[model samples]
Target: MNNNLGLHETLELHELLLFKNTCLTKANTLSEVAQDQELKNILKADAKASQSEIQDIQKFLS
Candidate 1:
């Protein structure tokens, strides 16, 4: 589970992951509240993209 990442890289990646998860959560919430179909679609797309990003990160991890 360890790589050559220094402390700064590790912290930055951790922060990045947390931010991505937040984006996913916010997107899902906004998607529910979005009245316009177009806006809702965009929010759903954003959520999907965030999930894909998490999968990519998992690839880097495993």
Candidate 2:
């Protein structure tokens, strides 16, 4: 299987990385003010996963 990204694919990945970063930021910020314990835990988990995904995307880009 091919592992290289084409120009279009690279651009799309860049966009996805940006969107993920936004999601991570929102998840972190919302978790701070979340009233429900379950909701806060969910947001924290999302943020952690997002961070890992962001690192993977960055590695691919590099």
Task: State which candidate has the highest lDDT.
Answer: 2
Task: Check candidate 1 and list the clashing pairs.
Answer: none
Residues 1-62, candidate 1, lDDT per residue (tens digit)? Answer: 43767777767777888899999999999999989999999999999999999877665554
How high a TM-score does candidate 2 get?
Answer: 0.90
| TM-score of each model, paired residue for residue | 0.85, 0.90
Model 1 spans > 4 angstroms off = none
Tell me the lDDT of model 2 at 35: 100
Q: Model 2 RMSD to the real structure?
A: 2.4
- Candidate 2 regions with alpha-carbon error over 4 angstroms: 1-3
Q: State residue 51's C-alpha deviation in candidate 1, in Å.
A: 0.6
What is candidate 2's lDDT per residue for 1-62, written digit by digit as tens?
11687888888989999999999999999999999999999999999999999998888888
Residue 27: error of model 1 in Å? 0.4
